[model samples]
Structure formats: structure tokens, C-alpha cells
Target: MTTPLQPRNTAMFYFQAWISFATAMTAMGIGIAYLPVSAWVRGFIGLGALFLVTSSFTLAKVIRDRQETETMVNRVDQARLEKLLSDHDVFRPETV
Candidate 1:
């Protein structure tokens, strides 16, 4: 037996990855251009950099999670196939 692919789950992951990557890029741009001597401007820059760093970390985690999930799915498929083969004795030893 073969398992059908889950498009919705795959789409959700892609959406999350895109949003996180875009957010990181936006934050990095703000941090770079908003530097100033004024305390408020400095604060904004600091917050922007913080956002960029956090988003990057989140993106990395998400990617790792996706990889893990895919690996688990493959293992499950392999297990199912093994069970089917065992049930039917697809491979038999030579007659004695």
C-alpha cells in the first residue's frame, strides 16, 4: 500500500518559509538604514536587528522541522511495505 501525499501540509510549510524569509529581509533592511544618533532611532535599529535575528532562527528551525517530518513519513512508508511483504511472504526460501 502507498500513502498519498499531503498537499495541504506541504503548502503550509512553504507559506511559513516564505513569510519568515521575507520578514528577515525586511528587518535587516530597516536595521541597516535607520541608524542615527537620536536614542529613538538607535532603539528602532536595535529592534530591527533583533527581529532579523529571530526570524532567521525561526526559518532555520522550520526548515529542520520539515526535513524531520519528511524523514518520518518515509520511515512510515517503509514500515508499511515491510508489513505487507511479511503478511504475504513475498520472498520465500528455497524448498527443502
Candidate 2:
């Protein structure tokens, strides 16, 4: 009984996750950029920056795909239910 709302929920959930990650990454970037840090530390910060960008992109794509898939499924379910309900003709009342 998965509805279209389910995928939307999932997409929102992932989006939230990405926002949290972005905040953490920005914090890390600020810490590395402003602090009197060593070369090794700066290198690590650069790597973290790369990781953050890639991770955010991947998460966004996944969310989009999931939402699209769910919408299709929901549309199909609605059509099927509509057809079934229409097929039943309950207008004739029989005398028992």
C-alpha cells in the first residue's frame, strides 16, 4: 500500500540529511580556512571538501529518482482502483 507520498517523504528525509551534512561541511571548511593550521590539516580539509560535494550530489540524485518512481506507481494504482470501482454495476435492486 505504498503511496506517492511515501517517496516524497523519503526525498524530504534525504534532503534534510543533505542539509545537515552541508552544515557540518561548512563548519569544517571555516575551521580549516580561518585557523592557523598546518599543511597536513589543510590537505585533510581539502579532501573533506571534495567528499562533501560528491556526497551531496549523489544524495540529491537518489532522492529525485525515488520520488519519480513513486509518482509513477501511485498513478498506476489510482487508475487501477478507478477501473475496478467503475466495473461494478450496483444499480439494480432485486426483490428477495
How large an RMSD does model 2 have? 6.8
Instruction: In candidate 2, list every pair of residues with a backbone clash.
Output: none
Which of the numbered candidates is closest to the native, going by highest lDDT?
A: 2
Q: Each model's RMSD to truth, in Å?
A: 6.4, 6.8
Give the TM-score of each candidate: 0.53, 0.54
TM accuracy, model 2: 0.54
- How much lDDT does candidate 1 score? 0.78
Candidate 1 segments whose C-alpha is farther than 4 A from its true place: 1-36, 90-96
Off by over 4 Å in 2: 1-34, 92-96
Candidate 2, residue 16: Cα displacement in angstroms equals 17
Model 1 worst lDDT run, 10 consecutive residues: 1-10
Q: What is the C-alpha lDDT of each candidate?
A: 0.78, 0.81
Q: Please, what are the lDDT tens digits per residue for candidate 1 over residues 1-96?
A: 565574456788989988987887787666666655787777777786777678978998999899989989988989988898777864766578
Best by TM-score: 2
True-vs-predicted CA distance for residue 2, candidate 1, Å: 20
Model 1 TM-score on a 0 to 1 scale: 0.53
